[model samples]
Target chain A: MPEAAGVSADLSIFALFWQAHWVVKIVMTGLLACSVWVWAIAIEKFLLLQRTRTAMNRFEQAFWSGQSLEELYRSLSSRPNHSMAALFVAAMREWKRSFEGSTRSFAGLQMRIEKVMDVTISREVERLERRLLVLATVGSASPFVGLFGTVWGIMNSFQSIAASKNTSLAVVAPGIAEALFATAIGLVAAIPATIFYNKFSSEVNKQASRLEGFADEFSAILSRQIDERA
Target chain B: MRKALTISAVGHAVLILWGLVTFVVKPLEANTTESLPIDVISDSEFTQITAGMKTAKKVETPKPLVEKIGEQKPVEELTKIEKKPAIQTASAEPMPIPEPKKPEPKPEKAKAEPEKQAEPEKAKPAEAPPPDPALEAMKKAEEQKKVEDQKKVEDQKRKAEEQKKKAEEKKKAEEQKRKEEAQRNAFDPGKIAALLDKQSPRREAATGDTINQTASLGLASGRSATLTQSEIDALRAQIQACWNPPAGAVDGRELIVRVRLQLRQDGSLSVDPAVMNRGGHPQFQIAAEAALRAVRRCQPYRLPIAKYDVWKDVEVTFDPRDMFRG
Candidate 1:
């Protein structure tokens, strides 16, 4: 009857974490935090991108359905909204403000409307991409961080080996296991972050392009309207 | 941001809970403790060594264990037979109560019965059948002789069976004794010394000249004679863990390097370990330096501190042939 004595200590996840050297504990906790943050960012971005795309799609349908631009802008402007609606409201506001001057210099009105849409598009893009750097940083750095923890843990094991003056596998295996766990968690945090970071970033670029496309079409319509008004 | 944080926290919580429920360090299923290569002497054994005496007695096998059960069966059988007659006599009249007393005469009565039976067989017709007259006396005498002859054969058979049982018991006891002596001999210092001596030639073949040098150094202290083969192997394994052998050398296996280093009791090198073997072979110098680096990297070594006297000035040979072959 061997008591799994080759290496065993209530090797539950909690046990390994609890048994690790303090530096390794910190590394594991930090990596877990990074993983959690990555998932949080990914989830929020995923939902935000979906919502924005649906809003853009609905806006495009309404814009093509022969709905009056004035009526649509009036309906959308009252509600605090995002994406295409925000761009439309901003451009219409600038268009309306230009006319409110009584002496409408139609020459700059189209330019102002275009500038406002561009600003709104940029702001919306910034909001979509906010806090994405954390993911990138974690994806790139956590593995190295975990490796550091492992090295520190193995060093501690070696020190213990000398202190105890015993080289039996039993003596250092737990320490090494605990150390390697930090690397494992680090990879756990890193791989998903890396994969999602790539996916979400590409999605963000697609969203930005969609917003720009909407802005371009809206600006063209506004310039045509300005020409007819003049 | 809040939503993401909540989701992340929930995800981490689920992961931790799943890990908590599922992760278990199952010990290796096979027993690793059997005759382990134990490398240290305990404090009690340390005092014995200082006093120039043998260490604590090794654990011995429990002898005659099976024989104890074997020895008991016959007594139980004899008691069963003895109890049956006692029960029969008691049943006839409740007064005999020799259930307790019958064993005292059991031996004497058993011995007395055959002699008494022999005389009565011939004498009974001569003595008791006189009243029945001539015709019946001869016929009764013939009947008594036949019955007595049967009883004699039955008694002889029983005696033979018992003698066989006794011989079996003796053989079992002798086997038990021999086993105990073998166990004792295995623990004998002289036998161990002989076993160690037997290992040195193979060890010398394996490591070249390091073991002999360590052995001579140990003789001066009257401590251990040399690093045991297992200890040498352990050191070999430690150094090899860090060794990076040079590649691209033709027959790289032949470039064995020996490093002679002194260790402090703490298992660290006292000085830079020196490579003892060098040659004109192009790979020799590269392999030698790698060996020296490995020795430096693996230290402080995890040697048993109790045998530091023997291992302090030890030599280690790095043989890369196995690596090349493997």
Candidate 2:
């Protein structure tokens, strides 16, 4: 009776531990870690884009508020944290240099300003788009990678059961749970990544449009001032 | 910027809270104590305490001796008093005390006279007992009886052992004799050859005479021999008995062995030895040769005594495949 009791007790504990299955435990742990990482990236990207948008909007308003260019530049020059402010400073410097040229023409001045603005826009867009490609890759490919892992793990589980000659529910349930866990993790990683990628792309587009609009407006304002001076 | 700060702060707060909950909560739940019923206690402290109590009880109880004898008895009398309770009780009752006290002083007087008498008795026995022939004879008779009884017992034991050994030896000898007789009676090649030789020549001579008679009657010119059907059947059966094919020969191959023999004037097999001819599979050639050797070993063949001429120049065709097919 004691020997039987010992076996039964040990079997119960073993069953408890085996309930999760080794493969399921591994898959669940990976899913949990991936979920945490995705959430962190989403939160960080959300905050960064929000801050950049706000700063661009504030700097644009300050630039177009009927203040003298010299005064506005002087005020914004100290704050390099603003991306659009940096673009404005670079364009303004190039515009001033062209105005002081020996044979400076209106067309030449406009061309120089356009060139500077184009260069600044490209640089700012590059900075905003950093790490977005990696997000897209993770969004598109994570499900397949998790699928591969699930498939391999299930294959191994079936092989083990075949060798052991057991097909009971207790033996089969854990492997199935582990396979499902991998799929769940893949979805968890992919959904947010896909959503955030789309969101970030749209945000970047809006910011690009704002930048182009500001550049056009700034060009018109500068041309009016030059005509008055001439 | 403020919105971004708020979002970052909330994220850090959730992560830290979850980490703390995971690390601290589950361990506490797992470690909570559960009550269990006590069955048989195995603690040593209780056993030790019980043993000490029993020892204390033993020490507290009064001894039987102390209960019987007064505890205040004088130390000088204690040893004498402890030896025997009956004697002590008798002495303690104060009867016969006067006689015992008088006799104790007179023993020294009595002891000296006994020693004088004892020395004389010891010396007289040594001097007087030597002349007593009856005693000496009695002592000799006792010793002789002891020796004779020992000899009788030893003779009986030796005789029983000899009888047992003789029976074992007789059994072994009978077994050995039986084994030797069985060996002598068993079949031997020399005896068989001698028996065959003695009978074969006479039979062969008669067969030659019959063969010659049949040939003179023109039996060889006919399709069948001049011998009757019964005689032919008997010869076929005898030859069949003599032939034994070698083991493991191919069953598909056909083999034929022809033997030609000559007869002598006395009607025994004589001048030209038997010749063999083989046909069919080359693999069967080895088997055919072995079969021919067996036939030669069985020759001068036994035959009907009256059929000498018909059998003498006999040509027998040995076909093993036909025999094997059935």
Candidate 3:
């Protein structure tokens, strides 16, 4: 019965916002915007990350399945959505360029291939980790923004007291609720942003490391071929 | 890159849509019509006040109605048995279709029976009379009993009516008394306004003795006024510790409650603390109640005992300005 009565009291999010002072209302709006943007980033990042991992696994499996590297490279070159396939293409293109130019020493050619692969890995990692700064900003700043709203709301509440000279709970409850709601929204925006930011960053790091390993192995293969040819 | 942007845009749009839907769909019920700060009192106090009303209702129990019906049943049964014999003797002849000639009060009794059954009296008397009345005395006795039953029912009805009227009168009297008391205690706002107008000029013209008198009365026992500002501050602080106005009261900042209470030399409240100038604004009742409870809860106030002449009758005005400010 009390719970039902409480609901009827209109302590809902919208009502709290409506009842809030102008400053508190602005705070709530900002927090809401943060929440929406953070959630969108989280969703986009999660999907992209999942797709990248799946693609990397598929490319790794095909690369080790005893298929010819050149045939595999040609197939991946047509559509290299994943970082692994892109890295392979980058290294293979460098290898072809080095062979076409016989003026270059074998050691120099190998170094160039390795350098190209490293550059490609960095670019792929950067692309994969896009829009993560928004998450980081939201995570770090939302709570403080919420606190600012609360402080402003409380100031209004005090001013109301000076004007009315009455110390009843009903007068201040709505304002305080409005103030607290900003903080609550802040936490709501911040928590997921923080969690997913950390999760995605680590995933990006792992993917980058995997690509580096693949580049190193490919470089070794080329080095052995160059030694045999010399 | 394009897929991620599209996904982010779609997700962002959905979230904003969800927020807007929530904002428009549900509205706050404006049931906060009682602009009273009721939360000042504990739940138990509310229940106790409600329980008092229940007792008032319980005093007018419906048991009397049922008893009245039970008392009438025996007389009714005797009449029924008496009519049965007469009907048996006449049963031989062909009864008229309209039965207008039959002088029995069947319709009257039928109407009364429905009323009796409406209440569902538990003691349904089933009287089995003999084939005949053996003596004239017995017939007279049954007739007397029927007359007595009629009188008893009429008496019961009059009593019920009287009770209802008395209850209503008592309720009205109480309401009137409360109103009168409220009027008596209410401060005249016009007088306060006039006092404010004259205050500064009067203060400048006032003699030294009158100023001392005002100061003494403002913070003293009726006998001798010897109070210090620090002691008054201490008392105020003690009460302030107990005064937790509901959030609404703080928001309605213009509401300041001045409670006048008598305190013993020991600093305990002697009488029930009352909100001075109550009933001026109906909205202040809850806030007043809260202030009263705060004064009551912070008993044995830490006032300076040496100046008993100064701190006996105290009036505390709770202002919400500092609370909201902090």
Predicted model with the maximum TM-score: 1
Instruction: For residues B168-277, write the lDDT of model 2, one tens digit per residue.
Output: 99999999999998988788877886656454443112211112211122122222223555765665455567677655554635566666554432333443334456
Q: Model 1 Cα displacement at B40 (Å)?
A: 25
- Worst 10 contiguous positions by lDDT, candidate 2 chain A: A4-13
Query: B1-326, model 3: which lDDT tens digit per residue?
Result: 45655666677667656876665534344332434333464432322221222223343311111111111212243344443322211232434455434334456666866875675456445533222324456778889989988998999999999999999999999999999999876788767765565544431222221112112111112122335568777888888889887565555555678888667756777666767755454457777887898999999887767666457676788776666666
Candidate 3 lDDT = 0.70
> Which residue runs of candidate 1 sit more than 4 Å off their true CA positions?
A1-8, B28-326
Which numbered prediction scores highest in lDDT against the true structure? 1
Better of 2 and 3 by TM-score: 3
True contacts kept of each: 0.59, 0.01, 0.21
For candidate 3, the per-residue lDDT at A56 reads 84
lDDT by residue (A193-214, candidate 1, tens digit) is 9998898889889988988988
Once fitted onto the true fold, the runs of candidate 2 whose alpha carbons sit more than 4 angstroms away are A1-37, A100-107, B1-326
Cα RMSDs, all models: 29.8, 40.3, 31.5
Rate residue A105 of model 3 by lDDT. Answer: 64
- Give the C-alpha miss distance for residue B291 in model 3, angstroms: 42
The order of the candidates by DockQ, greatest first, is 1, 3, 2
TM-score of chain A of each: 0.94, 0.80, 0.91
